[model samples]
Target: MSTSPPAGPTPEEMRDMLRAMTLIRRFEERASEEYMAGRIGGFLHLAIGEEAAIVGTVSALRPDDPLTSTYREHGQALARGTDPRAIMAELLGRATGICGGRGGSMHLMDRERSFYGGYGIVGGSVPLALGLAWASHYRGDDRVSVTMFGEGAANQGVVSECFNMAGLWDLPIVFLILNNQYGMGTPVERAAAVEDFYPRATAYDIESWKVDGMDVLAVRAAISEAARLAREERRPACVELLAYRYKGHSMSDPDTVRDAAEKERWKARDPLVTFERVLLGEGIMDASAIAQMQAEVDQVVDDATEFAKGSPEVPVDQLADQVYAQPWNDDPRGSALVNP
Candidate 1:
């Protein structure tokens, strides 16, 4: 006799997942407003449509598990429990920002939260995650390292190198490929010879899984299993999450590359909208509950924006402080002076 399928998330867990997704949506929307209003500078990438993939993957990880992310990582950081005010402050270049206003949109880090960072370079987080996993393996700890990148970064040579080493040493790590269809205007089909990314890890003897990233529960389940394989068995795994982004690659793009029909088709299955139906159908939440949650999320985003606006700017004297990991003083034998 065959065993039954695993159970789904409980009512409380479902409610939390929906709330988290709503928060990310509202935060990104407000962030776009800030950027347009000239408050947030530099390039901004919004994950308007991939909330399920982010929240699902992050929710599956342990508190101590280290995770790295690509540049489009506001959702990842938020899902990892970074305060919304701090994230907004970082975007606004405030001293209270997560990175002390040094690293902005593409480079948020919270070491205390085990969110390694959001790297600007494509595939940059892979090697860092590998190093984190290696450290855990060396220390005989079970903490897993999760590195998330897009389909575009999958082609990076460094990523393949990490895959080889991870398989060779059986490092406890999970490589999550957020295949959102387009890598800055170029479709994955046009860029990648193999559109199905999970199979790439098989060459290294690493386990792999593909999941419906539009469904939060499905993403959570798939990532949960992948993380378990890494943590319990001390092996490497890969998960390819097929999701979509509703906005342009960056705020600068006109988003004219993709066909309008394709976008509408995807929007019909919007994670938030579809999940709301699921919640209602399962009797986990009602229309009033969803409206209430949306209102609360909006208020949270508004408060975060105000907090960021009110936070102090980084002092000019502290500009060169964190340039080098270790402090260095001016000396005849050394280089020029760098004040703190």
Candidate 2:
């Protein structure tokens, strides 16, 4: 958890990361406001604190490499280049949204970006990501598949099964375990038999390590190295990103005294603030430049909010659409696979 970052990013690279992390933070804050105001519905999970983990790892990927994520993925999507307006509209359940408003916050996806999903199930998407890695291996493409899940998911039998398959096939995959301490109020210590989760991968002989998830450079260094090994070596790896979420598990989880105190302790090392200090301490950015970057990020989130509000809602009659994959022929009803 305390490993040092590889050589720091250049000034411009640091500035870009600062801007991206700022965008994710601002977007989550605005999304929280919208959810409370009833502009968004259903379960709304925020990644206000884990931006560095999502952003840093994603920044290290190739554009075509496939990736899947857990429900708390607004930050992941934004960091990996998903359209903000589409993501916001999806949360609002509008027709203009990604997945045509069908997937909502937990299913934002874009095949073009290789972001396979915002999976709602705890570890449901692991096999899908593994399949992608297999596809790369099969085609000799060498693209690594990244699948992220919470610490609680590490306990799933299906997760273990997939680990077996990954090792058995020598698949180019990376399991990104985001250890935020609590799995919906259940502390990891209470849930996991082993507090240190990476060792679980050793059972399958996959490479594994832990990284300081709050530090973008460190997360990048560790994840990038893992990805490189996965890509070049055609093997699987695991990374335990030590991070914390400042908000509740979802909009429905009531805030408590203990939760508030925990947030403060973690906020003292807020990823954005910490990174900004590094920028300032190193003279990469002055106060004014930092403020201007934040101001710009605020505008981006504000614009996305307005776009979601203006987007059209999905029609009730079309509810049955997108329920199943369309058949080969023009008429799905006439296709043998569909008719059968």
Query: lDDT of all predictions, in order shown?
Result: 0.91, 0.87
Give per-model CA RMSD: 3.1, 3.6
Which 10-residue window in model 2 sums to the lowest lDDT? 1-10
Candidate 2 residues 164-282, lDDT tens each? 99999999999999998888888888998889889888789888988888988888888888888798878899999999988888988884624576788898889989999999999
Q: Model 1, range 217-330, lDDT digits (tens) per residue?
A: 888888888888898878899999999999999999999999999999999999999999999999999999899989998999999999999999988767556854445454
Residue 135, candidate 2: C-alpha displacement in angstroms:
0.5
Q: Which residue pairs in candidate 2 collide?
A: none
Distance from true position, residue 321, model 2, in Å? 1.5
Cα-based TM-score, every candidate: 0.94, 0.92
Which sections of candidate 1 miss by over 4 Å?
1-7, 324-340
